[model samples]
Target: MPYFSRLQERPKIISKLYSNVITFLTYIVTPVLLFVILFAEEIVIVLFDTSYSNIAVLIQILSVLGLLKSFSNIGGNVLIALGKFKVGFYWNLIWSLVLTLTLLVSLQYNINLTEFTLVVFFANFASFFVWHGIILKYINIPYINLTLRFSLVFVLSFLFVYLLKSFIMFWPSQWPQSIMLGTYFSLLVLVTAYFTLLLLKNQKTIIFTLWK
Candidate 1:
């Protein structure tokens, strides 16, 4: 309501609000994305057993797609909100063409499942930048701020996970009955800490309003 209410009289306000929301969401989700990517093997093993072990790689790869889609979806909504429906259509068309053409080219080489997935992932990644570039023309988003926050979150999450992994690997085998149990406990703690800090930092802001 706030965004639409001010759409005509104060689009600058809407743009700022939308940019902040996107940045906040990126911070929140990037950690989870990193967690999933880093532990894809363990996750697959725990959830589906070793029978479908090969799917772990796919999960890790597609995890990136999830992040890209989040940004692209938000960008699409921004275009629509601004009544730039034609721009949104062009963005989608470009994405489709990128994915289809890349897949077709890869097929010529008789690519396997993993290779095929990579082609699709790369195509989305390529188109993501294009979509966001179009979005910038319509919305006064702080692209640098978004990039910096995303980089910071990504680095912090990666370091936390890496340290957790390192500690687990170095601990005496006799200390823990199961390494997997230890990993899960440590990850839970770290994830909790991450979110706790994030919430505390943004507590004064109307960050959650982005969802509504």
Candidate 2:
């Protein structure tokens, strides 16, 4: 009977784990897609032959912002999972406040849209880290270990993408826009595939044990 109970619980455990994973992925992807869409105009302007100084500044700001946002997302998910509903709500509220304040300050200083957006991004990122810390504390999880693992994956994937982009830069200037876009996407796909394979290889031993 005890063995049967354990067997019965396995399906439920698996189902819940699957659901949480799906929810987390959805949360991460949706905001990213929305951010891209919302900033499309700024992105297009930057992509064209614009002032490299401003573009460089914008990129630097946005990159840090992006990192922060990613951290926040993971932190938020952890908070929700740990059953700290009030803490999560307050964290989100604080994030909104930070965004609003940053926007106001940026406007006051006459910052460009791209720069302003980057400020917003960093603000959100900070909020996410704060919330993440809170969630980890609540759940008694090791924050350093998880953060280092994610950082390793992120850096590796970014290097792959950077190299692919550099290679694309050497293509003919007269290449059709469609071709350029296709090449860009193909490279992205290849990078993703490479990363996926890397992840699988890294986890192979654990996966084999589970299957056996």
Candidate 3:
């Protein structure tokens, strides 16, 4: 947000911007992540081919990067907005170097997808926290609330998506016959359930204009 540009000049507004960012991450990205995690195998089956099912586990691990990189993305913007652009630049440079080194080292060994993904996840997650630490000196992030709320919503969203996936997998002959049908029904259930939960929590704030 452009408002972040003046954060140093107007420190008090930082909290409002941080709050909105957290809400956007919590309400929106978390659901997508939940979908990726719960249905990674089926999603993998559909997206590429059934042969790539092995990568679904990799995708599940990589899905955590959604939340991590969300913070990193916002932190990059904060650094640029605060006129500390080089910090963001150099930090990313280091991450790239580490990734390259990891890949090079792995080439010599027989690293599985899960093990490789774990390495990358730590690299990205550590960089995310480092970037956020630099930004926290300027921005007033609700660390505890953001963590607790996001974690709670993540579990709830995962359970919701898991239930839908389970029904699609184990239900009777009503199971969708084609991928197109299955996708449509999955989206229908997902969007409806997610918005319903949001509405039950905060109808006035979250569910407004959802139809529009």
Candidate 4:
């Protein structure tokens, strides 16, 4: 049987599992491995030379690009699982073209690395709107409604993180790296706790565990 037919037959089971596994492996594992391989040398240099700014710049650039590519793949995979393969293919193609053009233009104009990074991030985020429309076409889902609910929780979490960071910044600078790392993790915990409480209060369907 063709792939689309299989999806149509058992969408809730097959599609969900396929989408979840592929998303985890592609968005998580592949990117980590790629970063390790691509920047091994730069990472070592940064460890030895703490003042190395290139590594930070490289990280900023890669982080945005990685997010863009990962989300593009995710949107495509979701469309495929919903048995809208053509929409998946076309949108992915369009996103790829947009990224390529943006990259070329950035290079041509000699744009500052920070500005280039921001441009790429915005471009990637812009595609999500289009992807949401495509997802709704077949699923009849209100992407905006879902996004708003999640965004509320996300904003609250970010606020917690910001507050924690601000508090830490006021601390004495003589703190050990171990102490700094602990502080960072503590902030993460606090933000996560805040978000968890908000989610429970809102009683939103927890799709993250299902996908995980």
Evaluate all candidate structures by whole-model CA lDDT and list the values in order: 0.72, 0.51, 0.70, 0.54
Cα RMSD to native, each candidate? 3.4, 7.8, 4.4, 7.2
Give the 10-residue window scoring lowest on summed lDDT in candidate 2. 1-10
User: Between candidates 3 and 4, which one is better according to lDDT?
Assistant: 3
Give the range where candidate 3 is weakest over 10 consecutive residues by summed lDDT: 203-212
lDDT of prediction 2: 0.51
Judged by TM-score relative to the true structure, which candidate is superior, 3 or 4? Answer: 3
Per-residue lDDT for 9-117 in model 4, tens only? 5655544443444333332334343333344334545455556745566564665466445544555555666667887777779889988998888888888877787
Model 3 Cα lDDT, one tens digit per residue, 1-212: 56567565655455546655666667777877777777788777777788999898888888888767775577676667767788778877887898899777976788876887787888777767766777787667778877887788777777777777777767734543356436744784577567646644663332232332
Among these predicted structures, which one has the highest TM-score?
1
As for TM-score, the candidate ahead, 1 or 2, is 1
Tens-digit lDDT track of model 1 for 117-157: 99888877877887788888877888897788778877887
Report lDDT (Cα) of residue 157, candidate 4: 43
TM-score: model 3 vs. ground truth: 0.77
Error of 3 at 45 (Å): 2.3
Q: Each candidate's TM vs. the true structure?
A: 0.81, 0.59, 0.77, 0.61
Candidate number achieving the greatest lDDT relative to the actual structure: 1
Candidate 2 — which pairs collide? 68-125, 72-128
- In model 3, which residue pairs have backbone atoms overlapping below 3 Å? none
